[model samples]
Target chain A: SQTIHQWPATLVQPVGSPLSLECTVEGTSNPNLYWYRQAAGRGLQLLFYSVGIGQISSEVPQNLSASRPQDRQFILSSKKLLLSDSGFYLCAARGGPTGTYNEQFFGPGTRLTVL
Target chain B: AQSVTQLDSHVSVSEGTPVLLRCNYSSSYSPSLFWYVQHPNKGLQLLLKYTSAATLVKGINGFEAEFKKSETSFHLTKPSAHMSDAAEYFCVVSDLWGKLQFGAGTQVVVTP
Candidate 1:
């Protein structure tokens, strides 16, 4: 099992402000981490995922970017936010061990409301 | 390429009644499917998964999903609906290459 911690349960930002959301994982080593955004009426969309430290793969092309500075940390950032960025962002870590390998454990999520 | 479609955007059920959530998926090969539930303002939780195993997959909290390859369907069902069961459910498909494609969520409302 992987325990994920996300920061700033809620955020409100202006259209041009910079953005940063952090997710940290514990209880596993070299685990897979993912960032997803959930919009109203739509399901969660994979934004980026990291397999290891300093290795990030972007799933969707957008102004947003992701970084894995540490093995236990995944950060999502944007140089300039857009109104469309308003949504619920989630951080998930894939389950470890043999039986739970395919499952993912999620964080409480961060709700961003860009004005 | 893989994609998932949840048939309903919303479903309402009475307590102690049955709950059904329909899902259809498309993939190039035999894919891995999963069901996840999300409570209000909370994160998504894995309810169950089907990875080329038994056609009938039993999940957490008395939830189950039937994988019917002939129909390309993996429908989730629960015999008794609890108030806690009211949440947003997602149907997801995995390509085994680190990508989990998700479907539009279905919001379940349970009434007393």
Candidate 2:
């Protein structure tokens, strides 16, 4: 069985502060990782996705960016956070052999409140 | 282009009543559809998926969805509503590159 872990289940950051959120998957290698954000009373928005290490694709342009430092480790970072950056950040992973129907598995998520 | 539409933004149903959350999709090619549930302040959970093999797909917690290519619809249903079922549901469509396009989401409110 594979498990995904995210750090700082809840975070409170000041405006203009730096942000870092980490996600890691155990029991799987070379998985597809994704970063998503959900505002209050809204659906999810895909921020970034990575098919492999050092490869990241941005779905939407914003203050946030994602990086895949290692095969199973993904990080979401921002040099300076904005008030609009406050939301529930989620990490998801999908197993890959390159051509298969893979359903994404989500982590518990991190709630970031900017004040 | 691929897109998904969840018909109702919010749905209220009484306990013991049937549940229906409608969804329609548009895709250039044969698409993969999925339904995910999200509790308050929680991550989304996979409810069911239509991968072209089965027209009718059964998922966890007594939930099921049927895929209708003719109508371009994938609607989710349950025999009876439970209070535990109160949550937000999202309709998702996968494009050729496996990118998921999410709907605005439907909030299901099960009343006792």
- Candidate 2: list runs displaced more than 4 Å: none
DockQ per candidate, 2 decimals? 0.53, 0.65
Prediction-by-prediction clash tally: 0, 0
CA displacement after TM-score superposition, residue B8 of candidate 2 (Å)? 0.1
Output the number of the DockQ-best candidate.
2
Among all windows of 10 consecutive residues in model 2 chain B, the one with the lowest summed lDDT is B93-102
For candidate 1 chain A, the 10 contiguous residues with the lowest summed lDDT are A95-104
Tens-digit lDDT track of model 2 for A88-114: 999999886655667888999999999
Name model 1 segments beyond 4 Å from true: A95-101
TM accuracy, model 2: 0.97
TM per candidate: 0.94, 0.97
* lDDT, residue A41, candidate 2: 83
